[model samples]
Target chain A: MLYTVLPLEEVLEGIEQEPGPTVQLTLGGITVEAEPLGNFQARVVRVLSTDPRHFLEPHCQPGFLIHGQIV
Target chain B: MFEQPEAEQLPEREAPGLQTIKELGQTVTPGGPLAEEMPFHCLTIIGQIEGHLVLPPRNKTTKYEHVIPQLVAIEQNPKIKGLLVVLNTVGGDIEAGLAIAEMLKTMTTPVVSLVLGGGHSIGAPIAVAADHSLISETATMTIHPIRLSGLVIGVPQTYEYLDKMQERVIRFIVQHSRIPEETLREMMFRTGELVRDVGTVLVGSEAVRAGLIDEVGGVGTALNRLSQLVAQREGGMH
Candidate 1:
């Protein structure tokens, strides 16, 4: 699975209205749930996997989500 | 009955000369006027300078953590009339040394640097960082290229990255000191100076001749120059 990282502000600007509990991000087909996580800030953080079409065999370890916030 | 105890009984060892072990300790105390008043406002010395966090064993270099706060403190304190920078460093981390040099370049207070034992590598920038620089007639300075320590990728991208970093150092040194970029580059890449290294080793008078240092003098000359600069600045203010 491929992932995309983007700044929170950029993601918000692209979305028309307040996203729901699970908002589908535009870059690198990523669907993140706002309910499960907290609000995004000005920095870039890894959200979820990118587009489903390109999603290959899951090479990542199970039971853990790769998420990173900019320092 | 004892046939005069053999001479072996005359003490096997000569009196051990007064073995004196001197342990010099540095004490930390709260700031006070007594601490603030001194002949020289502040003395900044770069003992050993290697341009990285983890230094070589037996390597002597200045630690940025130790020098940074001192520079900031000296700048903010109005009581500090002069700063004396003593350089006896071999120059380690370029960024760290340059950070220190940049701070010294911008300091409002007068600064004088005296290169003692040896000021080489990034020490070149530090030696010239002050308003007036001095060196002992026997001291030496080495002008060398940027060196990498740990594992480094050898791809084109890696080379590009290193080139950019080197450029940053060169730009900073040129901006702060009188040495021109071309001359510095020539010195940095000069071959056969060090047995296995590609740099130029300049002795005392040579360093001054190369425009890397101001004059050939020791502590007294350095302090005198700093005092003069301080007096001039203060006089202008009054």
Candidate 2:
């Protein structure tokens, strides 16, 4: 049950479609799901960790480029 | 919308401390990285707050389970002085958002929430949950009745269910913030503010005036306030 103010149509517009290519790997002691930018670099999709401080790291933020790929 | 600073501009700088690009953006040289040490943890609550079901991969989501554990970890870490919650959310699941808000409210650590873009619907509760709340000059917060976005349960009792859910959210906001219950109700049901919806849009200063958010400011102001709060807490501890 969605309680958001955003229109459901817009939120779920692509729910049925394919999500394209992505890779899930462990980086900096955290799990990172990213969209490959090739040449060994990737744009962060999400940084997963149980530690809240990890989210504070500018390097682990979503949308920031995570290169020096560690799988 | 903020840039990643000078280091991001040049590729060579990324590897100065990190021997390889894959060393996870950390500077591991013996001298230590030049980055300033932040006293508080910066936890971002953005995109959709995924509830019971996993949102499809196409949707950007903040899973409740992921956040709940992190909140617990922050509380357990004594070195972490405060928490900076950066919210730019459309407000997904009610239970999830409220749970996150409740966690922040109950924690002993000082928490500051800053609304950057749009903190709408369920986001309102989370925004006011902070020890201090701030909104960017142009950021907005929409207060409205919660709607069943996709399906209707098709029963007379459904309205009651939705009403009860709405009440819970409104109650939470009023309990956390300085907003009067009556004013909140009026803003929520007010018409003409949104073309397709019936509600009031409180932009930055409006939200501050309405007592929904504590101040009108951005990242720098928020960080400064967070530092002050951390100092206050430390003074009390000693």
- Number of the top DockQ candidate: 2
TM-score of chain B of each: 0.79, 0.85
lDDT per residue (tens digit) for residues B1-238 in model 2: 5654565566885546545444655444454553444567888888888886556766678878667877887788887789999999988998898999999999998999999998988889999999999999999998887886656878989988888988999999999999999999999999998999889999999999999999999999999999998889889989
Query: Alpha-carbon error at B75 in model 2, in Å?
Result: 1.6
lDDT of each: 0.60, 0.83
State the lDDT of candidate 1 residue by residue for B1-238, as single tens digits.
Answer: 3464454455645222111101101122438555456646544444444333434334333556546656766776676678898877755566787778888888888988888888766677776788998889999887766654346777888777777877877787677666778998998899977787787888898888877788999888888898899889989998
Total residue pair clashes for candidate 2:
3
Evaluate every candidate with DockQ and list the scores: 0.01, 0.51
Q: Which stretches of candidate 1 lie over 4 Å from their true place?
A: A1-71, B1-36, B42-47, B50-58
Give the 10-residue window scoring lowest on summed lDDT in candidate 2 chain A: A62-71
DockQ of model 2, rounded to 2 decimals? 0.51
Identify the runs in model 2 with alpha carbons over 4 angstroms from their true place.
Answer: A17-71, B1-37
